[model samples]
Target: MKDLIKDVHENGVKSDYKEPKLYDVVPKEEIAEFEEVMREIIADIVSEASDVACWVYVQKYVKHKPLDDMLQEWSEASQFILAMDTWFERLMAD
Candidate 1:
């Protein structure tokens, strides 16, 4: 949990890391829409999963927001997913 919070705090949305080139193919508006929607979805999942087992939370998370193939190559998006995994793992362990 500490790592999750620390990672998120250190790597907030506006970071020094370069935005993935995947955004180049889409219109800026489209990319912005996707990013906003995905972030909202992620926040919702994390909030709701606060009391569930890892597996159950994962099931709900995936069901609500299945991984989009287009985002597969976006490291920025992937980083958030990875961070959420860590958060969920630690949260569920308790």
Candidate 2:
């Protein structure tokens, strides 16, 4: 490429800017923080839905699911809601 030639001809230097250090990443705690944020988001959505709303979801996903499945889904949904509320409270307080 002409750009490469220009750099060599003009500056007489060689360095690859495209190659980067692999250490420029956050630690595991940062990933945990993101996962917590996602859990909180799911919780808020579950709260807004209010009640075993997974039947519709199952129906949408696979078209017909049992009562037990729906109930379990609702339970998980409630857990997410609680977690989301907690996250929001903490975030807003901060």
lDDT for each candidate structure: 0.59, 0.58
lDDT of 1 by residue, 20-49 (tens): 685676777698788888899999877755
What is the model-wide C-alpha lDDT for candidate 1?
0.59
Compose the digit string of candidate 2's lDDT tens values, residues 1-94: 8998898889997867565433345465577787788899999866666543333444334665544554465565655444544554466579
TM-score winner: 1
lDDT of 2 at 51: 41
- Lowest lDDT 10-residue stretch of candidate 2: 51-60
Instruction: Supply the global lDDT for candidate 2.
Output: 0.58
Candidates in order, TM-scores: namely 0.30, 0.25
Error of 1 at 39 (Å): 1.1
Clashes of 1: 0
**What TM-score, to 2 decimals, does candidate 2 have?**
0.25
